[model samples]
Target: MIRLTGITKQYATKGGMREILKGIDLTIKPGDHVGILGRNGAGKSTLVRVIGGAEPPSSGTVERSMSVSWPLAFTGGFHSRLTGIDNLRFICRIYGVNFDERLAFVKDFSELGSYLYEPVGVYSSGMRARLAFAISMTIDFDCYLIDEVMAVGDDSFRERCKVELFEKRKEKAMLIVSHSHRYLKGTCNRFLLFRDGAITEYEDFEEVYAEYKLLLEEPQKF
Candidate 1:
């Protein structure tokens, strides 16, 4: 289970301190599929970062009893100077997983072949995304944090990714934030609408989508 209490995030601006997240409280349990909806810069990603421990909350606590993954398939954390296999070893060390045992899986899944021996700086964006996503699957996380990364590649690759994440990991918890309401409608059971730095939780899809559409049509009013 994961519990966020009084979560708030603030950033320094020329004018003054600007708050992004506003004393939000949330709980995520096993098999909970949560979909987050909000306009750009409305603190949807900010909340995900706070919950995933990528960034700290200004005035709140995040408690986690289960293993929570960082935003799925995030590629920015890799060291450009390091080889793909080197970064894999580093990640495995940090996560206390067996590097040797996981090597075959990553190698086959990423389909990087000999490219894994080359520096990450030389890899293309698509290659890097494939490597990162394969490594993500190496760890058995209790909950996955997904920030608009619905799919990563061509038709067949995307289908494989869907099967691996949504089908194989269906029993696990997921927190998804996406602009595509259709994807969220199919993937999540619980919904959260972010407005004015606050969260409104709902279970019924109709209720959440109705409000989301209203916010979309009149974003300034909300």
Candidate 2:
């Protein structure tokens, strides 16, 4: 189970201190599939990061009973100087897993065959996403956090991922952040709307989408 009580995050801005999240309270249990939706800068990423334990909140508590998988962004966290295979080995070492035994799985699943030996700095965005997604899926965790990752891959690859990862990991809790309401409706059982630095769980996807559409139509009103 995961719970956030009175959670808030403040950032130091050029103008002044800006609060990204203001008094968020949420609870998620095992087997729960949650979709987080919001406009840009609505604190969606901040809330996910805090819950994933990557960042701390300003003045609240985030409690979790399960280990969280890393966020699914292909950012520059991996060293650019090392090869893709080398970085995968490094990640395994960080988790205290034997690299030799996992090498085959990583190579086959990443489909980077020769490119795995090349520096990650040389790979394109899609390649990086494939490598990161493959490696992250290998580890078993109690919860998974996916942040707009499936939108990158081709249709076939996306379907494969949907089956292999999302469908296979039905027992674990999941928090997915995406702008596509259709995807969210199919993937998650619950929906959250983030607006004005607050988060709330909606009764259904329609309710959430209605507000989301309204916000998109009139940004100032929402």
Candidate 3:
């Protein structure tokens, strides 16, 4: 289980410190699939970063009893100058997994061919995303943090990602952030909406989704 208590994230601005996540509290247990929805600039990505420990919250604590994977396909931690193969080895070393054991899987899944040995800085955005996704799957985490990574790749590649994350890892907990309502409704058993730095969970997907659509339609309201 993972528990977040009074989570608050703030950033310095010209005016003053601005809060992105405001006193949020949430708990996710094993096998829980939680979907998060929010408008642009609503701090959804910041919240995920905090939850994944990629960024620190201004206040509050994240207690994770289960292993938490970083936001799926996130390239922020990659060493840009390193070869993709080297980066894979580095990540596997950190997690105590043998790089050689995972190399074949990532090589096959990413389909980068000869480029896996090339510097990540030289790869296209799509290629980087593919490598990141494949490397993410090389480890077995109890809970996965997904932030719009499913939006990457062609339809066929996306289908394969869905199979790997949703179908293959069906038993693990997932915290997913996505704008695709149909996809979220199909995969997530619980839903949370972000509004004005606060988060709310509704029992019904359609109701919350309706609210999201209404937010989208609003001229300026968020």
Candidate 4:
């Protein structure tokens, strides 16, 4: 289980201190699959970062009782100077997983081929995203945090990801942040809408999705 209490985040910008999150409280259970939706600049990414512990909230307590994977497609966790293979080995070591055992899986899943031997810095954005997704799958986590970049790669690769994550790891908890309504509807059981630096939970996916579309069509009202 993961619980966030009164979370708030502020960043100093040229315009002054900007509050990205304004008091968010959320909880995720063992089998929950949640989809988060928001317009551009709605602080969706920042909220996910805070939940994943990649960024700290200004004021809040995060209680994580289960193992959590880093946000999927997050390239910042990798060392640019290290080769993709080296980075995978390092991560495996940190997680106390056998690198040798997971090496083939990551290699096959990423499909980077010879590029896996090259420095991660040299890889394109899509390549990096593929590597990140592969690495995330190699490690076992109770809950997975997925950002928008899960849409990486071609249609075939995306379908592969869906099969691996949604079908193969059907029991794992997931928090997905994406603008793709179809993907969210297919994968998630619940929905979270980010608006005015806060999140509104909805049990009915269709209803909330309609509201989400409405907001997109008329952003000024939101």
Q: Against the true structure, what is each candidate's TM-score?
A: 0.94, 0.95, 0.95, 0.92
Per-residue lDDT of candidate 4, residues 35-139 (tens digit): 999888888989888888888889998999988888876778899999999999999888899998898998898999999999999999888988988998888
**lDDT (10s digit) by residue, model 3, range 110-185:** 8999999899999998899999999999999999999988888888888999999999998999999999977899
Among all candidates shown, the one with the greatest lDDT: 3
Tell me how far the alpha carbon of residue 182 in candidate 2 is from the true structure, in angstroms, after superposition.
2.1
As a whole number from 0 to 100, the lDDT of residue 36 in candidate 3 is 94
Candidate 2 error regions (>4 Å): 220-222
Using TM-score, rank the candidates from best to worst.
3, 2, 1, 4
lDDT of 1 by residue, 12-58 (tens): 99879888888999999999999999888899999989888889899
**Candidate with more favorable, higher TM-score: 3 or 4:** 3
Cα shift from native, residue 13, model 3 (Å): 0.6
Q: By the lDDT metric, which is better: model 2 or model 4?
A: 4
| lDDT score at residue 162, model 1, on the 0-100 scale | 81
Evaluate residue 98 in candidate 3 and report its C-alpha lDDT on the 0 to 100 scale.
84
Q: Give the TM-score of candidate 1.
A: 0.94
- Every model: Cα RMSD to truth: 1.7, 1.6, 1.4, 1.9
Worst 10 residues of 3 by lDDT: 213-222
TM-score of 2: 0.95
For residues 1-222, could you state the per-residue lDDT of candidate 2 as single tens digits? 899999999999898999999999999899899999989888898998999999999999999888888886444577888998888888898888878767787787678889999998999888887788777876778889988878877777677778767778877899999998678988888899988898778868898999888877764531
